[model samples]
Target: MTMDSPIPLAIVGVGKIARDQHLPSISRTPAFALRAAVSRNAEVDGVQNFTDIEACLAARPDVKAVALCLPPEPRFAAAITALEAGCHVLLEKPPGATLGETDVLADLAREKGVTIFATWHSRFAPAVQPAKAFLADRAIRKVTITWREDVRRWHPGQGWVWEPAGFGVFDPGINALSILTEILPDEALLRAARLEVPENAATPIGVTMTMGIAGGGYEIDADFDWRQEGPQTWEIAAETDGGLMSLTGGGKTMAVDGKVVSDEPEAEYDGIYKRFADLIEAGESDMDMRPLRLVADACLLGRRVAVEPFHE
Candidate 1:
């Protein structure tokens, strides 16, 4: 699409993520023009706003694509509707509530002959590409990821996070998994997992998992907790043949052999829009479900433990 004649795009779900990331990125990138938005309680400045996805799609038939930034539990149906309407779909991270749902959407996209991008913005971080390239020829022996932050500080009164179908700690943890899956040398499976749920919540507040890689035999231990105090920590460190490769500050900084290599201002959503533009141009889908798959597997097989009740 030419710069003047951008692809008409609509956003389903005008939540916090939609406003903070999707709108800004779409505005900055020339690939897409925000045509409409669907939400129950919000509206964009100049774009058409609807209370439902069907109405949005029906009203803007010219919208060739849609971005679903709502919660994962309600994402599948909207995505299916968009794809069946002959519009490409861009899904926010964690794809769906379950791995099965994402698989279903993927199949539906194929049947409809439209693209479905399961976007993991963290994977598009500036350092991730270089880090993946740096480890192209190395053997990774171990990996450790520690993602701890205060939920009240970041999510403040988001009750859905504590629901049964909602992923809770896995919400942020999945970002780490997305980065790990992208940078790892081989597919990995969770060998063990322990989830600590607050007494009053349906979802866990903390989780610890151990993952095993294929033939090369690499182990990854991850800890995700929402009870951290003071400064937050989001880091992934891997021990490989090329010394130690660590991604600090949530993939914004990269270090190898105790020496800082690449550090840049965060622009994950910008990169995501750029990639979406490229995918639209190439007429291809860029959906990867491995990270979500791992999360599902962990939930399916993990042992649950009760903890103190959490209060917002």
Candidate 2:
């Protein structure tokens, strides 16, 4: 992998995200060249496509890098195979089925001397970096996250999202935490939570939680729901000593004291790919698990209420 040559790359999982974001981002990034795709149901034009990760790796030995967009259940396994094959791996957010799995993958990557990027696309929203800068010197009093969406609109027929380890509402909610954690000056610790789980689903359809910020008494109120109809909301606002700072449009827009500061069209996946290239070139890995840990903590400490069954 020389500085001049584009690194040969493969993408595992040709689902919605692959078509919607990953492929476009890869096409735009000169640091990588799409060499193959691994998916049973999808194929890339003018590129070698395989049915599975194993097949992809076997067929495309020239590919030294891979982006995994698989579900959490099999994410660790695919990552393990890629690492074992000496490829720099990029994992989609929430990393794996459990915190422990992500930890193990990190250790394995370290041992193998391969870079593993557990990418949080939401954190790459244009305003996030600026928000982080703005809040670095300010004192925050409270943080509130409002994330709501209709599952049917976004997920469509994605039934696995309601299963165990699917994280239900936390699937989208983790993006909020990722952005919040990225911009906040202090770390977050789960205080308590209440989740509303549908009768037929193993995960929650709604959640409300309180978190404590490190080194300060800043309280964080997180609200996530998948049952929201009509207008969807993804906003995080905080009251600070300087003023009120908010990141709306899921970190794409930043406002200070009710005035819009930064509002830009999102290119989150592009940022993600650029970061991945930077890490690969520098022989480093960026795998932050704080957001996932928060979700896990919520599940550990949360009280679940049975709700009406959620039908697709």
Candidate 3:
């Protein structure tokens, strides 16, 4: 709340997601000044650093907001601490270990009179809005999402992704679901799902889910895998009575009827930061639990199959 200064903000969890996206987004957002980093494994240049969120809050009273990019399990507590300290919060997606926890955090934020922005970054992908517009009121068809990437190349040595709370392939799968829900004409419900869990890992390395669009019997399928070897793919396509609608390149590209409609460089995190700033300024909260709810429902309906042990 320092006049003439950007809103002081602290970031918790300095992982790859933070370093590659959140940090740069914050640096470019004129509404925010990166004031502190709370992470034992990472540090930010010229910013105060702490091993944990409590210490960061204790040291930076001027910081009015916190952006948490930690694993979903720890994020619940970190968000609670920030809310208790009178700080607005921005939460990276899949906000908590369970849908119930996310609901609790939203209630707490309201009770505390603080805003919470539970970010679903993929919803900001440049082509998503265009795709949404294209599908509005003109849908009676099927949707398929294929999201695949090599965990070895992207996650590298990250073993936590295999932990129960890590959410395995859903870590990236949720991104697809986010975009799907953003563009689709109606709410989605998971009808059935199959998870391919590695014997050595607690979570699935791959998943296939069948979802039902509200008000229709359209088939919606999403396949996500962490074992893809080459040419990482992130694409979603729908067949409608009008034509084919597709979003490729993690929603950076949009096409209709096999013709490109929208294509642009992605600034998902930047868009998220801008939205967070706007919500904070307006004294409002923007929370969406749809994407995560679908994931939770998928988990509840999924059949788990044990695969061979995996190793990096």
Best TM-score goes to which candidate? Answer: 2
Name every residue pair that clashes in candidate 2: none
- Models 1 onward score TM values of 0.96, 0.98, 0.97
After TM-score superposition, the amount by which residue 100's alpha carbon in candidate 2 deviates from its true location, in angstroms, is: 0.9
* lDDT tens readout by residue for model 1, 119-188: 9999978789878888778988789999999999878878988997689999999999999989876888
Clashes of 2: 0
The TM-score between candidate 1 and the true structure equals 0.96
Task: Please say which candidate is ahead in lDDT: 1 or 3.
Answer: 3
- Local error of candidate 2 at 187, Å? 1.3
Can you give the lDDT of residue 10 in candidate 1? 93
Q: What local distance difference test score does each model get?
A: 0.89, 0.92, 0.90
The candidate, 1 or 2, that scores higher on lDDT is: 2
Best by lDDT: 2
Model 3 misplacement above 4 A: 1-4
- Candidate 2 lDDT tens digits, 194-243: 99999999999999999997665889999999999998899999898989
